[model samples]
Target: MSLGNTLSKYFNNRAETSEKHWDKDLQTHYYKTTKDKGLAKLEEIISGSSEYKINSVSTDHGEISFHVVKGKKAFVIGTVIMVRPYQTAIDFTVTTESALPFDFGYSSKLIKKLYERINKDLPLLDKQN
Candidate 1:
């Protein structure tokens, strides 16, 4: 193998392996919305983004998974869990696909981008309720 490939393998071996090297990129966001509303908002956000394509959705289980192929490649899986009547939690895992074992923080950036998008619209969603 080439020097770069050898180094990548060595580093990947040392990295966390949960969900196939995506452990560090897994993140959760809490929102003040109902489970149904949270799920709906997630669906709307993913569907509206041309960068993402829906892979599957399980409203019954409060999960929405999608893949984005643009400047940076990633597969995003999210879950909405209700804590109370109007309190909900959203969890996201962003996995970057690359020949190199390290993503150079691309996965984390993806999660932050999603959070920013959702957070920006949260107030409007709350007002409508």
Candidate 2:
């Protein structure tokens, strides 16, 4: 991480995962599972955690909105897309609520942490070997 990116990340209140993010760890992840199964596993992970509270879930839209109740408060939106049968992609958008303009990369770290947990419950499909 360059000083510029580090500074920008710290000074920002949100973090998201997409195919185009410069950070490889921030890239959207694909899993080997059906859309319904993916969403079910994700709901299990989030709802089972005391640190999180699910605000709403739209399985039809493949979207889940939740709030972080542990440590600093934040709002998060998780998306699950079915690119093909048994191939699903997942992404996250997190916005931390803080008195300061930034949460010192809290949002970014949260995405990574959530990804780790999700990967454990689901088979991650890496784009590259």
Candidate 3:
């Protein structure tokens, strides 16, 4: 094969591989950023608010106290599991670990679609560039 043709073929293969790597990296970064933003937004909404009161907060793990202190610091003081049955055999379980009250921000489909949209080289199976 001519040198020009060989070089062209080599460059094309490298570009395809590099493009795949970039797409994967971008997706991972997007997820990380989205998760962080969602958590931050949840914190912003709940913390330093009267809605999440200390006395009224009851969970299956335990009761918690929301302490608002020193400018913008808010801390939750309580157990993770609270059971309040009111003398009944039925148990009200408040396990914060399993309970995610915050938004996850991006759906998997959305993220995938986003990755496709921003990626300069996609549909690698039909790659011509």
Candidate 4:
């Protein structure tokens, strides 16, 4: 990672996963599952954790929003979209709640941690870089 990218992440309180993200961990991930199945897996993973409190789930919109209330407070949104029959894409948006200006990359680390857990439940086809 370049200094610019690293510093940006540290200086920001939010991080989002996208196909063209510079950080590999922040890149969009694809799973070998249907949209509903993918969403269910994510729901299970997040809801199963004591670190998160689910705010809402919308299967129609393919999105799940939640709050991290155990440790550092943050809002998280997971988006599950099935691009093809067996190819689904999941992305995350995390915003850390802190008294300071930034969470020192906490939001990014949270996304990475969530991805790690989700990878165990769903088959990771590839990372969409």
lDDT of all predictions: 0.70, 0.92, 0.29, 0.93
Better of 3 and 4 by TM-score: 4
Tens-place lDDT per residue, model 2, 20-125, is: 7878879999999999999989999999999999999999999999999989999999999999888899999999998888898899999999999998899999
Number of the top TM-score candidate: 4
In model 2, the runs with Cα more than 4 Å from the true position are none
Residue pairs with colliding backbones in model 4 are none
> Mind sharing the TM-score for model 3?
0.18
Q: Which ten residues in a row have the lowest lDDT in candidate 2?
A: 120-129
Angstrom error at residue 17, model 1? 15
Clash number by candidate, in order: 0, 0, 8, 0
Candidate 1 residue spans exceeding 4 A from truth: 1-27, 123-129
Ranking by lDDT: 4, 2, 1, 3
Evaluate residue 61 in candidate 3 and report its C-alpha lDDT on the 0 to 100 scale.
Answer: 31
